[model samples]
Target: MLTGNGGHLQHLCAQCTSCDEHAPSLPPESIVQMPEQNTPSGRSSQICSDRRQCIHGISRQTNWVVRSSSLPQRHHIYKISNHFDPIFKLEAPDQISTDGGTNLASEEMEAFFRRWLVKVHLSSAQYPESNGRAEAAVKSAKGLLQENTSKGGALESDKMAWRQHASHGDQRVASCVTGYLQLKEWTNTSGIDRGYGKNNVKILHVRREGVVHSIKEYEINTQLTLNNDKDYIFGDNSDIIATDSQKNTVYILAKKHGIVSPEDFALLLCTHFLSKYPYVEKAKIDVDAYPWRRIVSEGKAHNHAFLFSPEIQHTCTVSQRRGGSAAINGLTGMRVLKTTQSAFVNFVDDEFRSLPDMKDRIFSTIITASWQYNTVDGVDFGKIWANVYKLVIDKFAGNPDTGIFSPSVQNTIYLLQKAALDEIPEISKISVTMPNKHYYTVDLSKFPEVGSLENNEVFLPMDKPAGNITAVLGRATKSKL
Candidate 1:
């Protein structure tokens, strides 16, 4: 089956990210080659028409054949409001576009979409024909990708040149689909960070005797991956770290490091792994820090009290190879909105453009700023984080009494990144991802008394079909957003 990239659905991002759990699947019970005739299989166009006539007989099943889900993402998307979504733990998209397959084109599907507040766009019959049956093409591409291992340069042969034009969506979707292998199916990680040892994760809390796991519930999560030549090349557990040791080290390290910030803690973990083991040539660490604020009671803050803050989160990722410098990256999520002083105007217009040019409108966004630090030693990460956080919000709203004008989100991102680089030398570069959260003025033309959102001050906020704007600014080159 050709699985399309689910990038538009933000919830799928986590599922697509690489994890050791999706390691190389064991060899299937049976491996069957493509049939000589290339005859179409009746099993959704894959299996033979008659089970008894087939060579494998009635015992044959899909799990018997070697398979790969490395399919290219079509320009369009398919969304069904069926058990497929809820079983996958999705928040569901605001709209769905699909090929007019018999399964998708039905009153029940339309009713489900409408009841769930989902917009449905059905692709024309011709579109599906143009897309065509891609299973053979996908299988060919997957074979080529697996066979070639030339250190990732330009493809040498003319036959492979077409991959240069393949969209990133195609490559990403193919790489990450092998998640949680089936009991009898075979799969591989597509030569991306393969691991064979036990991989364990820990959520920090005082795990000592008489200490409830949720007492502190700091909500800090950490994962460590160590690599060396022995385990990977020799196929022995020589350099492998035990599961118990990993859990113990995580707890002990938390007590030693005191959890200053995610960046610092992640860096510390990376460095320790590199230093402690001679076999560990490379160490990568990921840490997520959640917000917990001390409770304030009666004009004073409680020392031993706190409340879980779920609005925003901080993430730190650190990686280092032995005898190499460490790379530290941090991300912060913040939400801010302004009622006025924002406008989006004069955009390139075509037949699809229906939005009238906006002016002095309400603009809001969930800000995700990703930055890499050039220097980590003797740096005050806490203070720098605070300053940068304040700076972005302050820049978003200039002269608090009356905010500054924002002509476009692109310009605002560029300005803030530029300002941040100017403000802090420790940061090497900054990339800002801000999705346009829209608030449309309630039309009062029916009443004929509100005077076009002037007399009646009311608006409706939307959470879907958000505009995505992102750019990176660096010391070496200032990117044009």
Candidate 2:
């Protein structure tokens, strides 16, 4: 339903293709007559022609049309793309004029337009003027209003007022900015950077040598740093050229020098931006390395066949400053479980204490551990990570000498932390979080003869309402778990 300036209502059919073919055939009862003071003095034929043309022109563009519905002083534009699509609507109170002299606030109008763009999925347009369909629709709507004003009638004043209202442009200004990146795989190393890829790079230990998969994900955003520069604010884009060059540098460096750990890869990326671009004082790079393990079949590892492993994911963050200072963090995930040596007991009695005491129960936890390196110099990150991870698992599952008799999850995690810090001295601090997965004993009270229930072995595993235990451990200080 489309409402005109004089409170006249018309049912605009979306299937109508042409005004001459559909306007005269519409039933008389479908159109609502305007009030005496607001009715136009033009002939009935001209009014019907203008109304049908406005509706027909909108439906022909992009297979979508938006119609306004009257609601007191507020007006809403509901847009539909197709018969199967949902209706997208936006309120325009300032677009309507009433006798009470009420209008929408400036903030309200801006928010309404923002929400409209998101609803119609038009906010991602790289160039707004490139949308020719929307431009054509605006032009058609404006021409329809101007034609109505030319017809002298009782609605001449109202028509002229609406023409002026539609002619005015929005007072607010908006800008849409975007940042993009690309990814590619590179192989074959030539030169050496830190004494890894040497002259024997032609035939190394593995035939599929160099990097298992030398692929990196990168993104560069300089909007915040350049927002205040006069050259950038006024549309000078020399800074954007610098950002695009960073993408090329990632491939060039990876092809020249072999791929190492994520920390090293991220550090190389950050160093390039700070050294090459004088305007870019600081740069942050984040990298994650996915592990691919060789498949073992018939007691031997395959040469080219590999399987993706989610057991451990390597992540690193490097922040480079203009003063030549950097910070790096190494993180990974480890899943460990013990079936017969974990317990939870000794808590204050309360109404929610429906759980029974147990001395032995299955304990399972997925641990996420992060360690900050004191210094990257002379440090073998791959070796240290493998050793530290093995130590953590060994402490959780226990060995033949120690046995598995954990009093609580907290105690087990503390021991795991202490073991990692004791063997790996390069790490300054370590943090671990363990979520307690419950495995409850199945109840068989309804059964007639099932021997003693205390000795029952059946159990039911639960995934929710689990306990969460976290701790941060260091060589010199201790924290709560």
Candidate 3:
């Protein structure tokens, strides 16, 4: 039994054997008396009257008693009926006391509730055994919230309405839209960026209008960093409108600005998104331009005709942040061959050294050259790329200064980079990957009448077990390459 002021019965303890008629009723037979040796000297401890009602096998029933004189006249009291209910009742402090003196306000009550809810939720997750009801309630609440917020659900309309409301909710979510331009007309003579085709026969077909119907199929992938307060965007909202608009913008820009090199076009795209969208903080634009070469007619480049060449492609990936420098990377395919200049020798000889050292051997490689520009502004990417391509081919084929002589692929790639960097000052670094396409000379020793194959004119092209060589070159101070 718990007693209040003036000896009033406030609560009937579960272990109480009997209660007065005025007090709450209790079952007398449920009371269990503890062993006398276990009792404390000054304090009284009671066990749960009903064995089935015990929690975690602990029988003690803790009681809290508030004296009537301690509470104000206006103070409210709430009783919890069962263990499933909230353990404590909350009361908002009154602004004025009964004596007309200043008291705590209702704002404190709101703060108290917020802190209490956070503590309850955190404790329920961290220590579920301490408050099973709180844990169960938290799980139920989460499931209910998800059910109300899921797309196409019954509460979807309300959730969306709340997200759109200015004072009610917030929207912040990231989205990416990828699109491909199947066919877009690009007139090269528009004078926007005229150095797209310099000293290359491929440019001859793109110089005239409608001559190259589908010169390059551009695949554009743009990601916009959106600004939302709570980072919650409705699933069915117009958050993807910007992405869809970017797809259309690609075609429109291609038709209007004319497709130059992939780097130039990618720069235009980065500029468009950063300038157009006020909410977009950064834009990442990646473009892959598929190559298309014109079918030659009697050794002449055909007009209004083209063939898709999937063997090679030009790629440009540009990342533009608001008020930041743009990072641009460009890559293209180039194949070069020199029948008697390349060699492989002086390598480590181990148990796996089955390959014989050769001072002079045929070199053929499909080169994929990638380079980075120092800056995108005011740079003639088309001209620089053309010069770089020519320099790579010339160096691979050997020049007058470095004639076609015996050397390793490593030496050849280094010289290739050195020559390109010497001519193109705008290029900060260049990376070249050359895979060795081996062509083995055939032997005719068994055939006596066929004569000896001394010159080794006849050969068999070996696809597997070929050597791979790669290297990157930059200025003396540039170590990142």
Best by lDDT: 1
Steric clash pairs (candidate 1)? 41-47
Q: Write the per-residue lDDT of candidate 2 for residues 1-481, one digit (tens) a residue.
A: 1112221112222322332222222122212232333222211110001111121112221211123222222322222122112222212111211112112223443354355332111211343332332333334444444455544533454443333222112210000000000000001111211110011111111233544422333222221122113232233344433444555566676666646666776667667666775645456665656566778889987666778777877666666666653444444666666778777788667998887788778888778777777676777777887877776767787676666678888898788788878888888878888887777877776564964556447778785988889998877755676
Residue range with the least summed lDDT across 10 consecutive positions in model 1: 48-57
Per-residue alpha-carbon lDDT of model 1 for 73-142, expressed as tens digits? 2212243333334512223332333445544447875666566554555434354431222222233334
Error of 3 at 388 (Å): 0.6
Q: What are the C-alpha RMSDs, in order, of all predicted structures?
A: 20.5, 20.0, 19.9
RMSD of 2: 20.0
Ranking by TM-score: 1, 3, 2
> How high is each candidate's TM-score?
0.54, 0.50, 0.53
Question: Which ranges in model 3 have alpha carbons more than 4 Å from their true place?
Answer: 1-217, 225-243, 293-312, 327-331, 400-403, 446-455, 476-481
Error of 2 at 137 (Å): 47
Name the regions of candidate 1 deviating beyond 4 angstroms: 1-192, 195-235, 327-329, 447-456, 477-481
Q: Which order, best to worst by lDDT?
A: 1, 3, 2
- Residue 184 in model 3: shift from native, Å? 42
Per-residue lDDT value at 169 in model 2: 26
Q: Residue 446, candidate 2: how far off, in angstroms?
A: 3.0
Question: For model 3, how does the per-residue alpha-carbon lDDT over 1-481 read when each residue is reduced to its tens digit?
Answer: 1111111112222323321211212221221233333212211211111112211111112221110111223422211122212322221111101111212123443344354331111222233333332222223333334645755545674454333322211111100000000001111112332111011111111344654454656677766654322233224343333455676777677777877777777778778877886655567777777677788899988776778876556776777777764645555565556777778888999998988998778888788777777777788876776677667667777575665564787887888789878888877888888888888877777677876847467778885877788888877674685
